[model samples]
Target chain A: MCGIVGLFLKKPELRPQLGAHLQTMLVGMTDRGPDSAGIAVYHRPVEANQCKLTTFHANPDYPWRKLGGQLAEALNAEVDVEIKANHAVITVGAAEGSARAWITRSHPEVRIMGYGQLMEVYKDMGLPADVARRYSLEGMEGSHAIGHTRMATESAVTTEHSHPFTAAPDMCLVHNGSLSNHNNLRKWLRRRGLEFETDNDSEVAARYFAYRLGEGATLAEALEAGLRDLDGFYTFTMGTRDGFAVLRDGIACKPAVLAETDDWVAMASEFRSLANLPGVEKANIWEPEPAVVYTWSLQEAA
Target chain B: MNTIDLSKTPVRELNQRLHDLTPDTNERLWRITNLKGEHALAVGLTVPIEVEIDGHVGYYCAGMNKEAKVVITGHCGVGVAENIMSGEVRVKGNASQAAAASGHGGLVVIEGDASARCGISMKGVDIVVGGSVGHMSAFMGQSGSLVVCGDAGQSLGDSIYEARLYVQGSVESLGSDCIEKEMTPHHLAKLERLLSRAGIEADPRRFRRYGSARRLYSFHVDQAEQY
Candidate 1:
């Protein structure tokens, strides 16, 4: 059992309250999944030539400043790092590929949680409320956010095993159900030169979308492809730089409730996560149908 | 008349209070407010009382009800009236999956659409949906009457038994051993009574009736491929 929640702000004025609203939503799902929790927040974009990397180290007191200095010298570019708990948001004036290569080679212990211009991913093995508090999720601001509380049905309960797995830049996925064909799919993806970070089934789903998108498939098209290829009872809430999407399998045993008001669009595994949102009483709430892809983006909202 | 605010009172306490009520209890009319999609609200009741929930609810809102009439003013989650023996559970808005699963008796009404498995394994309950129902509704239903005013999704009544299904709109597909039967006069009368009981006004003659073909009841060698 797992819980997924996503919020996309249609109105720009509600951007500052995104994390607070999402925090409440994630905490409400604690009963559904208490093993671990993860969140991905998409704030405003960085400079055109810069990319931000959310890096995690097991030791909370890891020398992030020394790593920043070395990264600056190695890349021959200005590097900025901000520490939060055991994670650091590293910004550099280079492409994601070069930065990732340098960090993996020089700082082997540091794990890159996510890399994009606007997104920062944080996850840990703990209760949802505790994880939220550890990262101060309520005070953060973003245009969109995706959260997952996992019960760890098919994998170990570790920070790496937690969800909101990012494969391609500016994209992440949180899944609520297990996949039966992940081992075969993972092998198929590995043959395509896709490097996997964990053996978790949900990670395979995330990378599958990334693989499809890499091959020039649109978000909806990639999801439709998933409907045909991915074999599972999954309710996935995925995030991109511009928006987020919700998809349920054909059987759709995993529940998903979508609510959209004039200000925001929210999707969760159950209505309890959405019950406390502002203007929820007037929101248009319904369950996403089976094998259907529902996407909400600021581009379309404009 | 009694009013219980669920925000201040826990669901377990409220259900216990309702369970303690006798058949002739003076507090027959009850109102619940601040219903923030909580689960198992007003469940396991045996007294003849009326419960009115003022907001959306989570799973199993009024399950195992015997003689109560529970009404939700907003949407409901999965299994709204699961395993109900008697009484009525009504949802004023849309309902999630398995709306009245394994219900043995009484009536369940959804004024809006019902998601997949609307009346799965229903024993004897009557479910009336003012709108459509999702896939595999009434799958393996033993005995009951399911009335849908709108469309029905795929595989309606896969392995149905004595239960009867009536749909006013189109059916995407029918399950194995479940075929469209002629809408007889007796079925029209029963549909009329069910619609009127749920306060929905629909022409009974426009609905189509479906039931089990009874082919799978005895299992013959020639029908092995269908299985």
Candidate 2:
């Protein structure tokens, strides 16, 4: 039994309260999932050429500044690394591919959590409250955020095995149910040049969406493809650079509730996570139908 | 009327207070405020009292209810009145999955839509939904009646037995061994009574009845290929 929560602010003026609202939403699901927690916040986008890479290392005292200096010299671009516990946001004045290739070639020990112009991913093995406090989630600001509390049904309870699994830049996926055909699907995706970071079933789904997006399918199209291709009882809430999307399997045994107000839209495994939101009493709430792909994008609003 | 604010008082204390009331107690009316989606609120009551919740609730709001009448003014989480024995459980808003699962005897009414498995494995309770219900509803139901004013999702009443299903709207697909039967006058009368009890206004003649075909009751050599 895992719990998934996502909040997308429809109004830009409410962006500063994104993490605070998300913290409450995540902590409310502690009883549903207490093993591990993770979050991906989309905020503070970089330039068209530059990118931001969120990296995680086991050791808290890892020399992030030294790597920043070395990367600056190696790539001939200004690199900035801001440390937060075992995670760091490394901003480089270069393209995402170059920065990613440089880190993979030179610093193989550092695990890149995610890379994009506007997204920062943070995950750890602890209670949702502790992880939120460790990352100072309430004080952070973002336009949208997605969080997951995992009970670890099909994978180990490690930082690497947590949800909000990232693949393409500014894209992450969180799952609430297990997949029966992930082992075979993982093999099928591996044959198509999609590299996996963990042996977790949810990571396979994340990379599957990435593979679809890489093939030029729109977000909703990719999820529609998942309805026919993927097999399991799953309720998935995915986040990308433009917005977020939610889908449930054909059987739809897993629970998911979506609520929307004039200012924001939120989804969780239950209504308890959304009960405390502002104007939630008047928000339009409904359960997403089975095999239906629901997408919300800020670009469309723009 | 007694008012208990859940924001200041814990759910445990509220339930304990309700449990302490005797059958002949004067406090027959309860008003619960500031629910904030709390779970296991006012469950396992055997007395004939009335409970009114003012907000949304989490899972198992009125499980194992006996003679109490629990009412929720807002949406509810999963298993709203699961395994209810006797009395009535009403939700003015929508309900999540497994709304009245395995209930024995009582009336469960949802004024709005109900999610997946609305009356799964129901024993003797009668459920009336004002709006639609999601997939796999009333799967393996036994010895009760289910009424849906709106549509029903896929696989309604899979492997059902003895339970009666009446729907006024479209049924996406019926499950194995469950088929629509001729709606007789007796069924229309029973459905009219059920709708009246739930305070819903729908024509009983427009409804359809479905139940078990009794083919899968026992193993037979003629159906060996299906096995």
Candidate 3:
């Protein structure tokens, strides 16, 4: 089992403070998932066709600096890249209509799980406190964010398997339980030409959502479709540039708690993670009903 | 007596400190003050230490307790004293579901009511509830003694195996394969000891015992739809 948390700040100025709050929340749930942690923050887009990418893998001998230079030269774009023990974050600025297309064409083997105009995904293999300091997460500035602390039961322990997996532009997802039908779904998706980088069930779910989104359904509609088709125990939350949503399987074998105030909306795998939130005593905490789809739109709320 | 106040200490730190103390060390008295739904209080202890939690706990309080006499002064949440190998856990207030589920050994005493499935899947652990127990209290219970001093809810014992159930009040119903057998003198004597151990001044002669009839384990076509 893993722990996932997502917060959609009503105020844009609180973006920088989000990393600190996310670190605190993730810290409280360390026991649920002590293997790895990751965070993805989404800020307002600066250019029409620029995308920030972060990739975390288990390889320690990756030639990051050389790869960054090569990628920059090949794309003919200004690229800023940072590589850590098992991960790398790359930001690229391309021509207005060709940035995403160019990145996709250049790195066809890399699974582009999440893509957005201003999204930055950082991940590492350790506790949240260590990952926060290692990634300098305290300085992150974004309108909203989502994170995952993974325990790695069914999947191998690697940064690539850690979540808030991005499936399409401006869309990301984090999950908290196992999917029983993962093998079947993986074969089905592969038959449809979807390539998977990791064997984690979370990747299958992320791609399923993306497949639906590609078919012109909204994120909320895709999630509702998932509740009907996806089998097994799960309580997942996904976020996009404009909105956030929560989903629970037919039987809630896992736990999830949601608490929202006038200022902030938070969801965690356990209530202990929400213990230190402001107005926790006053806020009403609720467990999402089984097979229910709950969504919140930051843009609509604003 | 060294008194440790848990008001300012974290639960992990407090449990660690308690575990470090020796068994023969002078009776350490701890007062868990200002507790509001904390979890895993006094868990996994081997020493004979006494801990009194001041208020309600969230879950798994005193879990896997062995050779430690821990007492909860207030209501306990799910899985309290679960999988206890030895020692005793006395609850002054109500207990949540699965109070002593899968306990291999030891004694669990609840002063107040116990919610649903109190001893579901119990194995060799003796549980005595002073108040009533809810439905499916001992579903799939394998071994040990479960004594209920008050009324038993629906399906008092379901699909049980060798676990002795003693209830003093009316039983709502018996589950599949469970039947009320004749209370022998040996059963009466065991019930007496369990009642005394739980510190209840009740008459053992007033309680009725229930156990597995062993008819469901082996199935026949005639009994196919009986369950």
RMSD each, Å: 2.2, 2.4, 8.3
- The DockQ values of the predictions, listed in order, are 0.72, 0.69, 0.06
Q: Which ten residues in a row have the lowest lDDT in candidate 3 chain A?
A: A95-104
Q: Give the residue spans of candidate 3 off by over 4 A.
A: A11-13, A56-88, A95-113, B1-7, B10-38, B42-58, B61-227
* Candidate that scores best on TM-score: 1
Candidate 2 reference-contact recovery = 0.60
When candidate 3 is compared with the true two-chain complex, its DockQ is: 0.06
* Candidate rank order under DockQ: 1, 2, 3
lDDT of 3 by residue, A1-302 (tens): 78888777876666778877777777877888899888887774646656666654455666656666766787788877767555666677764235445545765544443455767777778887788788777666766778889888876776777887777777778898888898999999899988776778887998899899899998879998998879888888888778888998765657666777777788887656766666655554445555778888877768
Tens digit of per-residue lDDT, candidate 2, span A2-76? 999999999988989999999999998998889999999999999888999999999999999999999999889
lDDT (C-alpha) at residue B100 in model 3 = 92
Summarize candidate 1's per-residue lDDT along B1-227 as a digit string, tens digits: 79999889999999999999988899999999998889999999998899999988999989998999999989899999999899999999999999999999999999999999999999999999999999999999999999999999999999898899999999999998999999988888889999999999899989999999988844567766876
Candidate 1 or 3, higher DockQ? 1
Tell me how far candidate 3 lies from the true structure as C-alpha RMSD in angstroms: 8.3
Per-residue lDDT of model 1, residues A235-277, tens digit only: 9999999989999999999999988888999999889999999
**Candidate achieving higher TM-score, 1 or 2:** 1
| Interface Cα RMSD, each model | 0.7, 1.0, 6.0
The collision pairs in model 2 are none
Predicted candidate 3 versus true structure: per-residue lDDT over B1-227, tens digit per residue? 44555567777888888888887878667667655457788889888777777655657988999988888876676788998889999887777667898887899999888867788888989999998887788888999989999988788789998899999999989989889988899989989999998898799999998999888734456865867
| TM-score-sorted candidate list, best first | 1, 2, 3
TM-score of chain A of each: 0.98, 0.98, 0.89
Query: Docking quality tier of candidate 2?
Result: medium
